[model samples]
Target: MDLVIGRSRSAAARRRREVAERRTRAIAAAAGVTTGAVLVAEVLRVWRRGDAPLPGETEDVVLAAEQAIGQTVEVAVAGYKGGSTRENALLNLHLSFLATFVLTRVSTRLLRERGRWGPLRNVVVGDHHIHHFVPGIAMAFLAGGVSIVSRDEDLDPYLAVPFGAGVALTLDESALLLKLDDVYWSEEGIVSVQITLATLAMLSALALALRVLRRGEAEVLEHDHEIGHGMPGMVVPVPSFP
Candidate 1:
């Protein structure tokens, strides 16, 4: 009798897993199709707009988006004193990581609450549940590897986006890793939030410090240059012999 009950339980568990896997596959397929469609649409739009100004009401929307993005870039560059490709890349990475983390947290919360995100939930395979960190690790490694091998400085910022996103994903589950089990949605998961906040604070402080240092250096250099060139209205000090 006990054997039969055990078998029944196993069968029910298998069925539930199968249903979850099916839902996961459906969600993945839909996402892929949507992403492909958007990419194709963007490509066609850009191709059609080549060397020509956008006309009509669409122009307003496009210009608005472009302006917003441009302003964001300008702000980041100014804040980080991003005068070089590497500095710009780091700034982009920092912004991307923070944005990804915020989005991830919101998505997870929605899923937990069974909100409007239909058919998208935890990924389960057989008896084990796959976490976001798995893909996060893979993405981080891939981005890091590409950045290491690529010689183009222009590509660094692009790579940094994905690398930052991956790191954010991984760090979002830091508490799970620390506990060696899923503590997400539990009180213990608060630790992950704390860690993420701490990291952001540290990075922000470091960037501010670096910017201050660079600005001071530039000012000193400029002052010295003016003194060396003997610019008008500039005073120079000379040593007096005793």
Candidate 2:
């Protein structure tokens, strides 16, 4: 069963820019994700290729060797490696935003219906209420914001700020949950002293976000049958902009 509201915000005569802004925000977030992926890939590629040590390498090489340690200028003419511009950063960010959104919003519903997780097992079996862990609103905002500010190479500042904030908040929220549940200390806790149970919640939320995205996409395919029968599209038009 799909839900169709009214016309999309675009139809209204006012606040045209806000509609466009939402699209832009999604772009920025997508770009940030792309940047992160690209950076990690580059790092791994360089690491695997056995690029020479960064600089001033010694036996006890943990952080002791500074760039200025030997006044080192090893001139082999092999220029440093890095890329300043990547393709469709914002568009990728928007894609990521949607991907995450579906994972959180859609998949959670399916799991709950299928009785996969405990909290929603019969309705779910446990009390985790895992959906709460997914940063739905925030994802929507950052993903949306990316497009709004794409003109400024938003991957760094806007995306990073929220990503940092999200991490901090996730940690804090996990801490609060553990404390509230009175499960802070236990035999299980002792076994995994370094990692908290909160992390499990985080993983569950991420899983939910991913699954929903897949299912939603599938459903979109199924919805093709309804389009011309006086039925709405998979994505309904919201009439809130104006």
Would you list the C-alpha lDDT of every candidate in the order shown? 0.65, 0.39
Q: Tens digits of per-residue lDDT for model 1 on 101-184?
A: 767877887977884466668888999878889988988899989988987888897898899889988988888998898877
Error of 1 at 116 (Å): 6.1
Residue 198 Cα positional deviation in candidate 1, in Å, after optimal superposition: 5.6
lDDT of 2 at 176: 36
In candidate 1, stretches whose alpha carbon ends up further than 4 angstroms from where it belongs are: 1-82, 115-120, 195-242
TM-score of each: 0.51, 0.22
- Top model number, lDDT: 1
Model 2: residue 54 alpha-carbon error in angstroms: 14
For candidate 2, write residues 130-240 as lDDT tens digits: 324346347546744774668566354346334433443333334335656633223222223212322343344344433333343334323433654436545666788
